[model samples]
Target: MEHRFDLLGSGWVSVECDPKSYRLSSGNQKRALAIRQLIDSAYNPIDWQLDFKSGYRWRADRLSGTLRYGHEPAVDVKVPWELARLHHLSWLAQSGDEKSIREFRNQVLDFAAANPPGYGVNWLCTMDVAIRAANIIIAYDLFISQGIEFDEAFLGEFHALIVAHGKHIMANLEWHDVHRANHYLADIVGLLFVAAYLPCTDESNAWLIFSVEQMINEVERQFTPDGANFEASTSYHRLSAEMVVYGTALVLGLPKDKKAILGGKNSFPDWYFERLERMAEFCVHVTKPNGRVAQIGDNDSGRFFKICPSFDEAGGTFKEQHLDHRSTVAAINGLFEREDFEEFSGPDVALDTTVVSALAGGQKITSYLKPGDNPGAMGVQITGGVDSGLSVLAQTFIEPVDATVLNGLTVFSYPDFGLFIWRSSRFFMSVRCGPVGQNGNGGHAHNDQLAIELNIDGEDWIADPGTYLYTPAPNDRNAYRSVHAHAAPKIGDKEPSRLDFGLFRLENNVDARCLCFSPDGFEGRHAGYGVPLHRHIEIQDGKIRITDLISGTKSSKVIPRIVKDGTSLRKLWSLDLRFSPGYGIRD
Candidate 1:
């Protein structure tokens, strides 16, 4: 049987080292130790305990039910690949036992044998399935090397399943959407693994080659030019990079046309590396005073894998770079005793990393937006709403595409329904929508259209804690969308009346000056592409202040005046953003 080692990715490396002899060597020892330590520390002894505890009794019963009746095979019933890999691998690794491994081997073989190939979710969980399967393959390979019996039938079945799934994704998935970036990596790598181990028949070989080419093209097009913004969360971006780089590396390792894969030496721009640096920077900056990024979008659970080596070590190899890559690289290198490593840098993250709250006595609460959309979205918390700090909107806008919505905007939410999405509109009007729901449709249905923060010096308070956990459960959505999560008082109506804030950019296209308001200091500038114009305003006690500053080609400024009854919070609450005529492109 001819095995093709060319199932992995091949790319430019500034260093020369024997891939075969590579192990956790040199300064890498620290990284290896860190990896092991993380796993060990997180692996509670109770996790390995076979007996059920009082707290997990429900979960234990549910698992028992699944073991007994869940496999009846309803067409709608889906068993995630990750769960299977976890079960089989955990059973094997935890006990060093062959019983579970052997049983799982048989089960995988039997299922593959019975089911037709390439029949699964084409859109949903595509990358997820691939990663779980690859992890399982890795576990199986490890076990077999240890003299644990390997069943040819099982191995063949697993390989065939991979090929089928690969073909399924190639034929169906929309490769254009940048949101599918991570999924593309997982699928590509999974296919490469299958090609390496399975029989390289004409059909399988062709499929493998085609999948690799398509994936490379997708990465180049989606990540390089437009760049993956990963506005969702820092952790998700890391996860995204992991799936892609890991899979790409596996494929590159396979014997193939390296030049074609890498688009020739110096053909691609260095933006990917730049993006990685930016992402790493954001991770370093946005993490709470502690080291946690807000868990907003699709973040789940995982420790950062410092031991996992990628093209990043060479610095600028790939086309889609994350911001924090530089810092993470530095931290990882420092772990391994590399002199080139950077010093640890970042604010102290809050311990809760979930939600924080404060009370004064008045009706003032403040919740800062979470860092990332997916996982980082969860990191948002509130503190001293009516009590501690005056209501403040300290925002550092990072321009990129949100991971979930795949737009150049960041979203904020009050768990279930109270939500907000903001984007820098180069056009005359600033565009925004709010207080939405999390029902897998267009962004969300949050009723809070144009929400702004205000700090009031008072004795009474109410605050909104950003989020605790995720949804379906009553409080799950509340983590991102409860009224108590923000400093603003909930209107009598369950929903706010008008929710969209529009801002038309003025034509002058110049940086607007900051105007400070007393009683409460405030400064905000409209920052980004198109026409550069902004309105900085402030409020304290019963006093209201407004500042109009817009930098444009014509250099103009409108006199500051209250447009509505400043004393009435309701009428004055509206965000009025208008642009001088001819401040934008002619329609």
Candidate 2:
């Protein structure tokens, strides 16, 4: 309550506005209530260095490495980072909640004091460092936009925090020699925010120029012409798309003098916006009739920002948390004003979409909601928002597609991402057959080549099992990512890909290919077992038929090995499936 307002953030120009003046359409009441709930919970308080999942409190004075995983609890560092993100504070400030606003400032000062630069578990991961910085900027910007003022002492401290995060990101970027995935992208995007807000010093401007150049190069390198993220996962597509959208928005809003630093272009070129729209198009297509994505690869339920609140933190609701992909869709739809995405996501999304539109300098958005409106006929009860994009977002690689319609539902294929989706009024099908992602490293991709996620009627009956957890829970992680967890063709004692290192990365030994693809059906194969294993899925009215064949092998001699203990032969393999709504929470 006593901290200086300027002590809140580094350099904020969009000040001198009124929170009372901030307004949203009455139709967005439900979403606004969600925002209130999220902020109210913030008062439940945050322990900046506590791993809520593991109940391990990180020592503030120790080096990040000094806190070993083998320590009691083998803590999940993300637990603290989640709350420390401070995104809820923006919603609080956005709503003109003065009490929560003061608490937001107080919490930041306390967090910085506890977790100084270069020490504590929060500072260990540069990606989290950058993400924290971005969230911090958003909250600070909103506060200042309301003409909130601060003392010089508080401003100095806040500026130091921004500089610290930027220095850490620059020093420890998540760059990979072969592929700069979402982690690297998070680094630059976070740095981009720091550069824009930090009073334009030489160091800050250097960060601006460097982040801009990296973003331009990576947009083309990371995403294919089809707009699918190279990460090979639907949830990840939402994740990466969020970062690209919000980060680009900030870049676009930069002054002409600042924008000119990008060589000659004032901002990202025409192609950048085109690809971004297509990225949203991918979201538009992959969504099932149930309002969730196909869950093509991994989905750990990661997000960039949370504008709404429906996610159960303990990961209680699997369908609610893991399967839902609406908020990200809503944000992108509103930001770009895509009627197509709005058609898929529905009009009620104005709740958070309006805020995103506000961030984009108030893009004109109209309501598409009627008295009775739902994404699907019986929409899944879900409410949430994503972090900039997940998220360490997902990827896969496949040869360019030769898509054709054969008197059936239209086929939407992401050739580079290796995803083939077929959608009609009541039936939706997505076939997962493609090369490995992360340059064949398959970092965020699952071993579900030739797999399929099916939705018939309004509800999701069969789907890919989501990522249960990572690193901390290796067995669960491996179990969820295994070929058995997906609806792919089964083989006797064969796995399409190896769970290399038994962690995030996978080996690309299996060659996934799309033999023939059309709206009528799909025929594809993988070279994982001894003989070429082929799977053909035929799209029929109100139904789908799947057929598996083994080439150059006798049915008798090459029969699958006898199975017991919850698993059967290829024909009957549902016995060993696992479903998880998100990381560390299973259903």
Candidate 3:
């Protein structure tokens, strides 16, 4: 099918922000520029140095450089540049010459159509999700503008591939189901757009729609309400919220004639808007002075915020409009107007929705180290709410860091070797001590406890971290998981002393404290001595609080507010931890 292009000048013009509503403060401008610069400087995965020893043959120097720069195409080169370039396209689409637009559309479409299998998996490191989506966006825009005949055959072929390999997509790519970041959400939206536009009969289209709806429902159910996130970072929250917006729009955009089949509204369910707002607000909660989000979970360090476009061409336009409006989501119950978005946005809070953002945010957050008496494996849950909150199930320290690590990994790890551990998203602050001591038994295989986001601004943080990189070799996989990334101890022995394992589960002013009653007496051979009460308390705000009343400890007055600046709470409680000389603790 031949593609045509429509060069509409009005729509292509740059968006204008309402000066009063979308004011760009000096600080906000600086933060935005910094974030842009960081993305510009770090948009090369070649700097990451990923190990390819197992598969591709290579010279030593090349291998060394790849290692240093994460030479892997999927993680390093492709994605970074792709994301950066795609964002540039979004920028250009608003102001480029007709010749540039035509050339850009042709090149991007050709590259996308000619990609390698697995949707260009081999070229992926060089092509981040942003790039892939951007390519789709460009193609879609070209098709829409030129009024090209929809390629029924290509759609059929794509659908046929899905029909043939639906199970593989389900099983192998299950993580996408749980992924709450922008990239995964964008993929989901793209798939939905394809499904919606495909010309198949009802019989063939039914299953696909069901599957798509299931994914959408999961996104709504898991990521909002609890105001919790796997990584507990700002950037990722932005990504997830954008995904929600994209998904909602795709659903709402279904031809009006087909609207009856869906929930039958011009927009998404009211609750979806609520959850999106909460997720957006939750990220705002963690926003800092700089426009760049505070990296909280396992935020990618090799590359930064390379601008990537959406898969659906229309989506790209929407994103561009939003970006021009500073990409802000409105407050609760507010209509998603571009002007209103600026009122909610500030340079201090650019939404970040990647693993890298999570780790970086984790470092900047000061409250992680405080003592909270709540302890135990918080019940793992994933659900949605009415107030537009995402539930992220995360357990704060319930037992000592060591014990919590042992218990959490025991339940969530690979289960076969006990050697390979995995956790839901946001497994940060890891320290491997030659694979022994706290690092040996406590960390690894996965990060610490299996914490769920209870509420993003009052909803649930869904799922855990999606496994984007996994290989047998230690270093290859370890690149994504480590102590240095997490907020835990990196010093020789700064790991927390007391084995306090209490999670501070918060929902706005309300928080549920979990504490594990050591079912059996402490029986670790390292210390040789049974310890004292294994928990303490540090509360913040007027939210109701619960403390684990260990059998022998007397009732004590615990501090209600835990400060972020490292000021000790007033006589809440203290521990006298005794570690044998050589051993260490983990945060």
Candidate 4:
């Protein structure tokens, strides 16, 4: 099933023009210098392909498909793709950093020349391909807006890169079954940006029509009724949300007629903005008072663009920063200027808000903003388009939730997301119970069916261990996602889900359910280990009381025990769970 785009071979780079531009601010000059300096940190120019941890280099001569994921000594394809994502280089060009700009240009030409179209591990996964191309487009568009110049030779080479990336995505789109995931969504977005930025041509226009329709349709599909991502992982929720928000803004910024396609007959419905707001609302609720989110599921620290700094003292590499979820809140706030979204908006996310403001048709954006002030206003209006089948199973309102769960604890339940949250001024807890993510493929869902992450008195107590790695080390991957990693009942060495399914999947044996959910407490059960295990959690007199109602007596050597909540404060200090919060982060 091959589709066609007019951009196939040489001379596809159309003449540059002042098509409506959403120019990103030239970020912090100091940080831009660091980014430019470290632009070459991830890849080895000698071979142009690399594995950071293992030092294994995939030669440019090899086809991406030839190098299998999780090969023996273990090579991560993400390392090279990290360099190719080109965010730092883009910023360098945007900042007018002459020295770094030269490096950026040279690197772009070298990488493109070394790894021709479909060669090397960098092009292996279409998801990465889409992300890489989108970033390159963003950089190029920004450079154009800033009046930065590039040599004719590099422009020719770069346009060829764009043509190749566009063709590769259409051919290898990750659309397979009834359930399409983030990867598919990203593919559409990449193509959308490419089509939007390219000079007016039938090929780019056709791509525009196809991608715009699909972006709206897929965003509706991938997000749950409660606004949680279908991937079942909170961090991944941020990644896919970014693709939708950023892509939507670019479409809104297009010239009137081109943008009319979104508001006319087909129209970009209101529900799209509503769900996006709720997705940001979900971010507010899941994040703890400590400012870090409860790593509810897989967090690869994935992003479409590094528009904002990771803000972590331990941050430098692409994978290091993920705990901060407020920037997403700020991005949403910037796009719609929704009053509810202002909760997480401040100095922390001023840059993020400014970036989104530019993309959403705001005026010339600056890198700074006064507190409580948004960048600029987008006069564009979104009218038309039907419901598009958007179901709001759980409603999220900006006002403080009035419902109480005994003793001032606020209860929030997103059944679609399979999470029950109870929070008070001094105590907060989240219980995981629901369908395996990715439509039960459980690609990003862990085996912690009855798992709970608790923070009492603003100190991390029990936690859901985060995803450390994928593909490269199978055992660690299984271990991190194992039921044993969380404070949930497990029967003597019996697993609730099979880890052997695949690196990215989990087959849930446990039909975990919440039988009783009320202000009193949360009572849930699961049949993951061949026996029904019940967990009753209630707060009493400010301390937590967790009871396991396992039928144990006469013939009962087999009984589910309540996993303890207290771990060493030392370990808790290590990472809120004695594990890295994201992939490639140190243990």
Write model 1 residue lDDT over 1-587, tens digit each, in one string: 01011101112211111212222224434432332332212221111101111111112112111223122222111222222223234234334475556444544443342223332221134554455455556556556655776556455556656666566545544344423444566566555555545555776666566666665564454332212222223344455444434344344344434324434333223343333333333333333322223323333322122222222334443321122333343332221222222333322211101001110011111112133323232223222212122222222211112222222323222222222212112100111112121111212222222223321221001111222222212233322332223322233333222222211111222122222212233333333233333333333332334333334434333333333221233233322222111101011
Q: lDDT of candidate 3? A: 0.30
* Over 4 Å off, model 3: 1-89, 116-135, 142-187, 199-204, 231-233, 261-270, 301-335, 338-340, 346-587
Sort order, lDDT high to low = 4, 2, 1, 3
Query: Taking the tens digit of each residue's C-alpha lDDT, what string does model 3 give over 1-587?
Result: 11121111112322211112322334344432332232222121121111122222222122111332344432333222322233344333434555555434433322223221232232233224322343345344434444443345444433443332222232223233332343444444444444554445564355346645655565554463433333332334454554454445445445644555454644334455445544544443333222223333322221112223221256444321111112433311122322323454533223322111221222211111125521111222212221112121111222221223222221111111111111212221111111111112221122312122111222112222311232222352342233222222122332222222211111111111222112111111011012121212222231212222222334455343332111121112211121111001111
Kindly indicate the candidate among 1 and 2 with the higher lDDT.
2
TM-score of each: 0.43, 0.79, 0.43, 0.79
* TM-score, cand. 4 vs. native: 0.79
lDDT of 2 at 172: 93
Q: What is the Å distance of residue 521 in model 3 from its true position?
A: 32
Error of 1 at 359 (Å): 51
Q: On residues 1-587, what C-alpha lDDT tens digit does candidate 2 reach at each position?
A: 22211101111111122212323234433433333333333332234665555556666556776666533434565555655666556666667566866677656665565566777778887777888898888878777877887666567767878898999999999898896688898889999989988876778889999998898788888888767889888877877887877777777566656666665465565577667767777777787776667877777556666665344446442123555666667777656665656666565455557656666666443323344552221221112231121111111111111222112466776657888877766657788888678787788888888887766555454677788666566676777788788777666556777785647688777787777777657767777764567776665442345666666644442332332211223225563555665655565
Against the unseen true structure, what C-alpha lDDT does each candidate score? 0.32, 0.65, 0.30, 0.66
* Candidate 4 residue spans exceeding 4 A from truth: 1-47, 260-266, 314-319, 363-407, 424-426, 551-565, 568-577
Question: Per model, how many backbone clashes are there?
Answer: 101, 26, 126, 0
Better of 1 and 4 by TM-score: 4
Q: Model 4: which residue pairs collide?
A: none
